[model samples]
Target: MSWIRSWKRLGLFALLGLVLSWAISCGSGTPPSTTGQQPSGKQEVEFWTMQLQPQFTDYFNQLIATFEKENPTLKVRWVDVPWADMERKILTAVSAKTAPDVVNLNPNFASQLAERNAWLNLDEKVTPEVRQLYLPNIWQANTLDGKSFGLPWYLTTRIAIYNTDLLKQAGVSKPPATYAELAQAAKQIKAKTGKYAFFVTFVPEDSGEVLESFVQMGVQLVNAEGKAAFNTPQGKAAFQYWVDLYKNGLLPKEALTEGHRYAIDLYQRGDTAILASGAEFLNTIATNAPTIAKVSASAPQITGETGKKNVAVMDLVIPKDTDVPDAALKFALFVTNDANQLSFAKAANVLPSTVKALQDSYFQTAPVNATPVEKARIVSAKQMQSAEVLIPAMKNMKQLQKSIYDNLQAAMLGQKTVDQAIADAAQEWDSRQ
Candidate 1:
């Protein structure tokens, strides 16, 4: 959830890629027989990858070469865009009728474009065989208002990573499995060891995790008419859980304003005992605090009543106007195929969205000489069986999140009562509708 801000910053750019067919026409005409040459008048399909340059240039180049060889009549011009400039570049290209045929983007950004009818619906273009390749929940990430607009790419699921040494110091033999157990452990750890038991993050920018915690507790966020529905008993209990932790000094005071990075930094420096985060973060622990890495262990992500997990996914989408829709989709499928996905996952230490790729031994088997990082990968991949995007997609999702967190902050700071906070948040959400 903390990572969402980066993508949302680019979301406004979705409006940039509008219909350009009226301004200029696609290149289409003659035929060529050369192995790598497009027919003399064929339009080159543009492919854009986000911030994958410098490190992944070679990998992408090799894949592009192979693809061109197989489809000699089609030419794909690959472009690497910086993360900060992706929205601008894509939007500008679209406005000028120079948008890429295929582009790599996140679900949230794709959702924005889909809402504007600026993308091609894969359900109408791709075959059933191709549709069956991805994990069902992940494939749904690209669907906005019942239309599939993107293909699943790489993803990561968060899990509980704890300091075994710190737990041992507090006489905690195993990590807590439930919220109640976690609170009790925090109390015991603070009383015995004087170290913070948990970093209960409350930063407004990353408050979605707290919202997700409530969802895990069975709090429906919105009613059928899109009105706020979380001002209920379950919501009160969820908010009170954190309120109790903060007031009793069981949680880090910095948590009142900190984000995941701060919590991770505390764990790396041996100031905290637990961290609920993505498996990829283990690599940072390995690099920044080798000492903490030695005593670190991973477990399936902690959840509430349902025992499900949350995931962050990346996807590839096609703009509405493209000279080679079929050829573009063919290349998108090729890039996300099992073999290619597996190769990329291995190289990047990420999880693949394709079921076959996930079933591969690389994700299924634990290494004999496993380190904390390896342990995290195995645990995370296993948890993916029950994982899904934590927050449901909505046209006003960002606005809803801000409304909830603002009210939550007021309550946490004693500016309002829990009931009043929920009421206020619900009112704000309703007004937005």
Candidate 2:
């Protein structure tokens, strides 16, 4: 009986010891039991960016590498897709619940995404310190319904880049300051130099930039109700202005088929005397055709009717599914901060989106062709302060822009009269609405 009791006591003591050991292990912060198995390594985050191939590929890769080096515990993988297919791919990924952990997108889509609750509300993530890094205007542009969706990574604006040699050849000493002056100059240049003086890449059916030109001319495309209001008297007048230019032989017929890229190429190749485009063209010229580097750029002339300068904006946005929202927002803030903005601006020949960066010493310094770039930058900065946002009709904006330009092109080719083209375009715009 004594031996049996001893064995029972020994068994009870062993059980207590085991229980204590298990408790201690838990208290020591041993890995908790997960449903399946423990992950082998640190968390990996997938990031997607709009097509950043050959030109910006290295810069972006280095930036990501630096981010990983600074964050040893986090791994970031990148996916690059071309701009044309980006929206479609991203939407597909979102639908499949396979969206990237971080995404960079344009601001125009940010509002739509926000409306659909497809983007993270960055207001909670971005600190006041982070907000101060970008220009107020850009920050506002990315904000929809009082919430910020993304940061402005880089920015570009349209400026009138003209062929200085052509201007000299035409005996025009100065660039046009107003639309009327521009028209008069265009007439004189065409008459004397036998070259198109102005090119409008406005295609009513597909050219968003052409619509932007109308907006710059103070033609409101939509009212408070978001209905298409571009067929108003002011809109008609703006459309007529383009028709007049086409009829007078001041603009090329090719402009109807030419989008922004085509117009920039024409000016770069010295086929046209003037082009309204972003500073990215500067780098394009430097890389593609070194000889045309002598061409200069100036502020896009204000129209005689509206006296308003037009500037288009591009911005950055965060998608809804970013896992490390805080860290992603911080990185965005870091990149757009004044110093990083300067770095990007210099690398891309794009204007800085922040006030501090724009006023930096680098931008103030005159380039080889100082006058035009400086003038354009100053005017663009001012215009950006009051730029209007374009919200197209509910259906077929691309078709509408194409139709307007197709008719105008016909007019330029002498296949239709200016009145006929304008009337037909108006009818088409009305029918589309």
State TM-scores per candidate. 0.89, 0.76
What does the lDDT read for residue 119 in candidate 1?
87
Residues 38-129, candidate 1, lDDT per residue (tens digit)? 55855577777766655667888899889889887777777666565677666666666667788888787668778878788899998888
Q: Which 10 consecutive residues of model 2 have the lowest summed lDDT?
A: 1-10
- Give me the runs in candidate 2 sitting further than 4 Å from their true place: 1-41, 127-129, 204-206, 286-312, 367-433
Across 1-433, the per-residue lDDT of candidate 2 in tens digits comes to: 0001111111111111100011222232222222111164555566666544445668767877887788766666666554445566667766655666666665665565666777778788777876886677667767766778777766555556677878888888887766667888798788778987766665443335556657656677655544456666667777677777877768887766654446656767777777655544454566666676666656553444555443334455556765565555555665577877788667655567787888876666556756444555565555555543343213344455566667766766778866677677667766665
Task: Give the Å error, residue 217, model 1.
Answer: 1.6
TM-score computed on alpha carbons, candidate 1: 0.89
User: What value of lDDT does candidate 2 attain over all alpha carbons?
Assistant: 0.59
Cα-based lDDT at residue 228, candidate 2? 51
**TM-score for candidate 2:** 0.76
